[model samples]
Target: MKRKLGAEDLFKINSVSNPQISPNGEEAVFIRTEIDEKDNKYYAHLFHIQLATGTISQWTYGKERISSPNWSPDGQSVAFLSNRDEKNQLYIINKNGGEAKKVTTLDSGVNSFLWDPSNGKIWISSKIKSGKTFTDKVEKEDKPLPKAYVVDGMKYKMDGIDGAGLVPQDSYSQIAVLNLNDESIDQFTTGEYQHSLQAISPDGKKLVVGVNRADNLDYVFKSPLLLIDVETKEETTIVDQNGYYGGAAFSFDGKYIAYAGSDHSYKNATHGNIYIYDVEGKTTVSLTDGIDSPVGDYAVADTQQGISSPAVVWTAANELYFQLSTMGDVRLYYATLDGAIYPASPEGEHIYDYAVTKDGKFALIAVSNPTFPGELFNYEIAAGERKQLTHFNEEFLKEVELVQPSDISYEVSDGNTVYGWLMKPAGFEEGKKYPLIVEIHGGPHTMYANSFFHELQLLAAKGYGVLYVNPRGSHGYSQAFVDAVRGDYGGGDYTDIMAGLDYAISQNDWIDTERLGVTGGSYGGFMTNWIVGHTNRFKAAVTQRSISNWISFFGVSDIGYYFTDWQIGADMQDPEKLWNHSPLKYAKNIETPLLILHSEKDFRCPIEQAEQLYITLKSMNKQVEFVRFPDNNHNLSRTGTPNLRIERLNQIVQWFEKYI
Candidate 1:
């Protein structure tokens, strides 16, 4: 008999990502990640598959994490980043098989790398210290003395760094080239700015990188694409507008560059568009001009691990292929230089990651659905055929009975249609009412799509109906709809969510309205706090890594200073306005028994947000509990330590079971 999905099922789930097609289009390689329950660690290795025979084999092994696998230009070797050594460094292994060879010995390790198409060299981006070289070595000491961090800029701290959320402000990411022939390395650009290497020209003479050299880097959010000459180090700003840009790729012919970004017209809620730039004509055209959906996958889920969305892929025919998030689905799309765009793959499933061949005939894609975790597939672009390539999660899936979420589309009070999904309780029986949990996604900018969500599945397994919706401030919708929540906070967006719950209850009579529970993290967490404070309808509520006071958030969060100005339309200068939209201001009105979950080092929302709420509720003799996770950042729910992730799920389910 099949059993419900337990918290420990996390150990059995295998996630596949970053599929890279061979240069000759005959084979493909991808990264398969599994959790080592004995060690409480994640182990990833490279797996290879033949396209014609559908045979798969493991190409690499060990306990360390591996990522960013790519085929060399000659297709004779595969290069990837691994933590087999202390830091994540570059490693290359022959295709025929053998032990992988370490390629880069940089002290700081490699951040990203690209294969030089014209020669035996690799362009990489690595961190360089203020006064030290990339190859410099430091003497080991038995007991090192403690050092103090000097007071510096506001961008000194970030989430998921060293578990304490502190980063060295003096270190900067710089570009370098490594010659595989002699194992010699050459440092290129050096500056205080962080450089993200994007793509290299077909001829290997020019490299495109994204950087922001603004004087006040904290306030400016622009990442302009700079075309730099490989030898001369001369830079030409190809996209210097007031916008955010990345994922740039040079066309096969080296005459055009395609990139994805937005003008930030709606601040963080702006939809991303694909633009093609003419290298010779110095002109740019938007390939997805009227496309309302955002480019790249915005489907929020925890089942996928180490997945990198494909940038714009250039075909030999001068066309481009990319992924876009539409109404609750991420689809592969094909575009032409003349500005025509259409779906390259069928709808109804989430295409988390993909790689297309140079000839544009085949694609290796990672697909997931409401009932499936994820797997790799070989897709024939022209014939619209998809063949399963890997069954990594087949055994685990067979032991658990998963529920498929039904589609939900309801009109809100503003005459706008909201999209979402509703999952019935696992092993649900008819004529029986069950408690319903309203799940909210973070990123008030990301959408809840047709993807497998482990948390929601666990909730359903525990006999709770789950309702998740993409409210007004969600991607995969119109720009106007997504930007509607800016400066409105608990206004229309709140109304839309409540209306969705009412609609779900109205359509399904088996929902127990009195036993309602609500939970969310980040922006969703803020909304959950707002919900409990505004209405006592929900019997139980759990808020995770949430914001309570916008005033304090303006100074504490890594993006708080500017994010407040962009999302809340207020800052420290306007304390009253900031407080008016803060959930902390309405703390006295909360009546639901609340459980606050937060990561101690979550710089995004900070544990202090949860502290204030817990303290305020405790002072009033209200039922409230706070759980603090140490040495983890804001991503505790998704990419935290495997043990902590399971414990988090247990906390949420136990809390709802006790109150609701």
Candidate 2:
């Protein structure tokens, strides 16, 4: 008997990511992650599959988290990052199987690493403190005293999985090379600025990385692609244009480097395009010129754990393969040096990550659709045949009754069509009118695609219709549409969303309009707050990690300083404009029963935004409540504490059940 998908099912699901094809292409290694219900933590282990026999085996096992699995040049061993010890360190294990050996013992551990194709040494990027060496030992004191954090620059903090909160002023990310044969570590790059490791040249003579060395790092958004000589320690600016460039890879012969970036033409809403730079000619050409969509996966979902977007890969044939966001779907694309582009994989599914062979004959892809959580698929590039390689979520799928969303296309007041997905409630009947819940996604720039979203499924299972759409500010659409929300936060974008809801209600009479509810996070959360303040149509609303005021946000959020000017077109210089656009300013007009969910340590939107809204409404004797998850960041819905994620979902369902 199939049961409705429960929030606790998160513990039962297995997530597979970071697939790396072996040099011989006979086997592939990937990270299989699972939640330990006993510890309320996520543990990942390396798993490999013999492509010829389709035999799967667990290569590494532990309770700790492991990530970034890569095949050695000779394919005799596999190297990955794991926190089995204190901090995340690099570890290596033989392909034939044995005890895993710890590689780097760096003080700060490894951020990311790559195998040098020529020298067979591991090149890694790790954080280094001002006065400490790579292998320095921490001296224990009799007692520790509390110290104050002296803030300096505007770019002082960042939001992420590891070291998420405040950044140390004296710390910087540096690059080094480790030789496993002699255990000798060569510290190569040292600087106050951070250097992100992109890739080592095929010949291993040079490395390409992204770094911003501007005088004012806070003001400049450009991280030019830099080519650093391995021996000479000299740097050459490969790309110094006014754009943000990353995910770089060198060609087979090391004659060209392919990367993805945007020129800030639309600020953060700009579309990312793939560009190839000639090593000798020092010229760059945009291969994806006419394609309006971004160069990577912008499909928004909550189920894929440890998933990363693939960089532009260079094949032995000199052609490039990359992912593209198109019409609410992420697809693999093939591009030629002469500027021709075509689809390499099928559409209707989100391809989160993929690895292609050097010969471009086969690809290992991690994809998900409306009903499927995610799984690895072995795709024959030439024949377009796809075979499932991993059955991580097979049992979970069999036990749950998941609802598939239907495609929706409707025209707004401006006559522009909007794309979205509508999921009928689980055990839905034709004559029964079900309450409708409007689900909005974050990144206002990210699209709500045809992907498996656990949150939406949970709502559908609870007998509520789920409606999600990529409004004006969403990707996978035209550049003009994506850039439409900038400088007009609650203006056209809000209308587009309201129009989508109106259109959805009109198209489906089974949707109970009187019991409408709204919920979203980040920018979506901002919109949810805006919706309640502007209209009383929604009977209940839940806002998560939302921004209610742009004035305080400019100083509180990690990206608030520039994001305010870029997205809202206002800054501290214009207080009136910021206040006028703030949802808190219109709090008095809100009548919907609101539930505010926020992470206490969310640096993106910050909890203060929610506090202000809660205080304002509560003081007015309005129906409002607040729930704060301690020690969690802005990513609570996607990758927060396992138990708390379940609690958060239950809160949402209970809130709707009580109010609607």
Candidate 3:
């Protein structure tokens, strides 16, 4: 037998998403995403488990992949959106066990669905029927039609395991209403407006929807929330609440609306605020004011989802739950909404999305760390106790070694204190200096928290010190901290990182700053590009799945068009601001050995972004090389081919060894 690579040796698992607590809170239903090595496809399935005994009652089967399981409020039936027909559609399964009833017949297929609160209809949204699907398809006008087409609701363009879908062009699941009993569907918010930001009240009489009227649709943060009456389908905008608002939900009683949004009135700062909008009285109050970071983020959980956003649940009552990240660890917190927000912090390594039971006694939280893949946990909030539920991968412990990161903090650029985590070599010596690789995270709005990351640990295992930071614009800190990076791209954040390198060298005389290296993906990648151009503080750099040219990104990336408008507050058509913010603008200044890692099929940052940077740097005679993962998309880090995953690690280790 052949020895397996570390990643292959380690058991790999991912989320099934939205493990719904049964309405009664005594039972729960969830989807489990597992890899089928032989079939070479990711499969997700529904499983019914009693909350008390922890024994599961399997629901769906066969080679067909089913996902997005939503339990009806009554708990007798489950409604899920499946692509079993190749054409995704809504299907109903009963708790008592029976054949699933396919609900609708549409060509483009249903992308998203919601259980109707008042009636038995399923609210669904799809871009299939709205227009013909197209994504850089090069077809001759005289050739036969692509099999992905359908005369009505039949042909589905799924090329692989029927799950890894086509890169979403204009096709996305919007918000709408579908009547389950009569198989009737009603389209809401017509005329070029996508009901993207949407949530239905418990009574099913109201919907809080976010719509982007801007030509740049990806400016989700700039989109405004509108209150719609389910009865009349009438709309109203709550004043003093304009900006980007999504992930909105109605309280169990429907009196207030809770959502994560930012104050768009100001251009320089952004922080996701938790707002409670009084529907009848028309009043909006911002929660987490002093505690929130200026740069806002997005999260979602429906009434059916096991855990709703704590920003929504905590304000009304006393016990509130929310997700927070500082450094690279993402965890869940149960706060006292009544007083000063005091976090009921979890003691484990990582606590991500969580749910509060209807009885307000229990919670189903997602937990994971370096070696521990995502495992389900059941907690009793009052008792201050928790129990592990689903063991996604138990055998991982048998073969692989998990790396643990120690949290580190240092002052940067300004007087601002920044946080990060450092992973030393497995057999690290206290007095010896080692080559340090600095890592940055994406989401300029998201955070790098205490969680399990294989790549970082593998680098440490390869005998290198790894440092990752949550510079300005990262969440979990106060709003001012996150908003600190708004229009100041390479300005403060770059300095913060440089200061961080100095601090790391100071604390760990073991760190060899002269042989130091830096790298990141997405926004982190953008920062990597920015860092190389601005300062040669590190000896080597690797920019992965990153943004090199914002000017071109505004035109090519899937969300770049709108993202450029909001992040820079300028359109790409104008070369002024976009070029100024682009890392490519300063490519000539790059002195570090820059290696570009990218995915061929990436749309989020696009493969061209990497090509542009590589070409520019090589042309300028700077030490640069480009490596592309064929057939891989933007998510190569988290989900990609097993061979490619190990290869990715190998390339990084080799690059740093050669140059750093």
Which one is best on lDDT? 1
Q: Which stretches of candidate 1 lie over 4 Å from their true place?
A: none
Record all residue pairs in model 2 with backbone atoms less than 3 Å apart, i.e. clashing.
none
Ranking by lDDT: 1, 2, 3
* Candidate 1 lDDT over residue span 1-660, tens digit each: 889998889888889999999988999899999989899988999999888999899988888889999899999999999998879999998999999999987878899999999549999999988776667775678999987787567877888888457787678898888999998888887778788999999999999998888877766768899898888888887898777898999998999999999997888888899998888898888889788888878888986889877678999999899999999999999988877889998878999999999999888889999989899999899999889999999998888999999999999888999999999999999999999999999988999988888999999999999999999999998889889999999999899999999999999999999999999999999999999999999999999999999999988898888899999898888999999999999999999999999998899898888998899999999899999998889999888988999999999999999999
lDDT per residue as tens, model 2, 92-167: 9999989889988877789999998853589999998876667666676789896787877898787753445787
Query: Number of clashing pairs, model 2?
Result: 0
- Local accuracy of candidate 3 as per-residue lDDT tens digits, 1-660: 212225444236455345678777788877776666676655667888888999987788756668667788788889887777887778999888898889876666676667877547777776642343311223347867655533221111221222233433445445667776677666665655555636787787777776666565232345677887877978898532346666676766677776766666544246555666778888877666665543121211100112222334432353455655533445555544333554454543556556678656778777666556567778887786888878656655444555677778887747888987788766678888789998888767767656666677667777788888778877767667777777778888888777777777777888887888998888889999999888878899999999988888876776666667767667846778778889999999999998899987777788899999999888889899999998887777766765676677778888998987
Q: Give the Å error, residue 201, model 2.
A: 1.2
Between candidates 1 and 2, which one is better according to lDDT? 1
lDDT of each: 0.90, 0.89, 0.69
lDDT of 2: 0.89
**Superposed model 3: Cα runs more than 4 Å off:** 1-5, 9-11, 14-17, 128-177, 182-190, 212-221, 238-241, 265-269, 294-320, 325-340, 347-349, 429-433, 534-537, 558-582, 585-591, 640-643
- Candidate 1 lDDT: 0.90
> Ranking by TM-score, best first?
1, 2, 3
Models 1 onward score TM values of 0.98, 0.98, 0.83
Whichever of 1 and 3 has more lDDT, that candidate is 1
Cα deviation at 598, candidate 3, in Å, is 2.0
